[model samples]
Target: MKLKTSFIQLPLLFDAQRLLAEINALDASCWRDHPQKFPGNFALPLISVEGDPANDGVAGPMRPTPYLEHCPYLMQVLEKIGAVWGRSRLMKLSGHAEVKPHVDLNYYWRERVRVHVPVVTQPAVRFICGDEEVNMKAGECWLFDTWRMHRVINDAAAERIHLVADTVGSERFWNTVDRGRDPFAGSVTENWHPETFSGLASPSPPRLTYESVNFPDVMTPWELREHLLFLLDDTRPHEQLARVRQIASRFITVWQEIWAAHGDAPHAWPIYREKLDAFEQQIHRFAGELKFNSNMSFIEGMNGLIFIGALGDRRQPTATQGMRRAS
Candidate 1:
């Protein structure tokens, strides 16, 4: 409802003409060519532009570019938020395109608050933050705790553009973020010890197994698919397939590790192998059903081939042929 913090307006304003020019110059074709990056039925690539405010080696996640570079209006707005938080890049979403509801997990949760300035919008574009729906107007700014559940949707026929920026938090908030840091770098395994595996030493216990995990009652299948598409869109099909394989591979590794630690029972190896086999077959079946014809399709095929090679079953042809076919 009420965002954790109140939003303040910045003095900087962007040249709409320049902003439109830049958006037009971008290679929208790249996203379309590689459908795998952005998948699902509704997720479509409108445009993406990059700018460097911190001049860090990596491009920060997508946001408006014009406002970040030269919008004096935005800079003044950030000044009100506090001195520590500076203006980051801004990203504009065109047409009725909308970003799925997601938490800013990578950043902003600690002490940073996200600010949104609606540069151009129609009534159909709604910004949902928690339970509150805010209809932004041109030149108006709002500071919100984006760490909570939030999403933007454009149901309007016209394009909706907003200047999204990130600012630093108060000293107390920064301290909380610092305290939550992972002491063992980014890997949870580093903190794991032999004693942590003690629970697996006991005989295998029955656990719930299902073909798929359903979404919570609050979300319908279409809504869930929309959210997934937002995540999947932007990569080639092969990339999506690779990502899926990577997840499966990690699961297999964990299973192997458990078996190594406590697989003395007669049923352990057979059961584990059977589960892996079933998973592999299921993924292959999904790949076949995707009807991949675009680059995304080819990528998915490559992932399937990789799985086939990794399993080293005689039924699958050699990696050489698989590679040839994928190419």
Candidate 2:
């Protein structure tokens, strides 16, 4: 999601050593290559679809994998964040590796904010977002704008690892974010103090909230309108902007009318699909060459957010056809 700044350091800290101990105890076989197979990038699932460690899909009910059930301190780390979690993992960047610069246009990411807790990292590992870059130290909590183009580079000889989690955020989480400081905001942390997790072992299991409904069977008209407005507002100036807006306005009007008539009933699926298909063709015709400020194509966002997910399954595109994985 977009933020007021490229990065926000939350007013919380964790026991990096204790977190690392839990990480170390885990078997090496659990780590998997990046879903896109970015060289030298790997991950170990903490939460995933149906609690299956091998599943990287963003849709379906999210649940904790066995990997999470055995780690007390990691659970404590998550609890302190105070948010309903989505797919999460321990992201590892091998020495000398880098995460290529890219913006996350996935529909799942359009609403969710990714949280980063640096469990193991070096000063030389720099996270670059837009015009700014920062070396997130171990145990520090942070959030970044996924909508902006960003990347990570590890110049150090040793590997770097971080606990990366996602959430739509909760009331408490937003409150915490309100208290957070942007790293570029000029010594904002001088007066602000942070709460630290001591990493004491838990006596019982931690009960955490997980997402049960992420994608929609048929998106509500209000939400679809909101997304359309957001995209139009974010589009960079282009010769086609005026015509695209006209098309979008007409499409939204038709969608709202259909929603009034059928309201996501199974019988309405065909109508919804037909309108969605028409909209897709119109959008691609006018806005295919247009791009967001983040350099992602506007059609990519439309496909990811509306075409594939707005009304249950349409035929899915190949990995190369739509938005690529952000992490």
Report RMSD (Å) for each prediction in the order shown: 20.0, 1.6
Regions of candidate 1 where Cα sits further than 4 Å from its true position: 1-82, 169-327
After superposing candidate 2, which stretches have Cα over 4 Å from the reference? Answer: 315-322
User: Candidate 2's residue-wise lDDT over 61-151, tens digit each?
Assistant: 9999999987898998888888999989999999999998888787788899999999889999999999999999999999999989899
Candidate 2 local Cα displacement, residue 99, angstroms: 0.7
Which 10-residue window in model 1 sums to the lowest lDDT? 208-217
lDDT over C-alpha atoms for residue 268 of model 1: 51
Tell me model 1's lDDT, rounded to 2 decimals. 0.39
Query: CA lDDT of 311 in candidate 1?
Result: 28
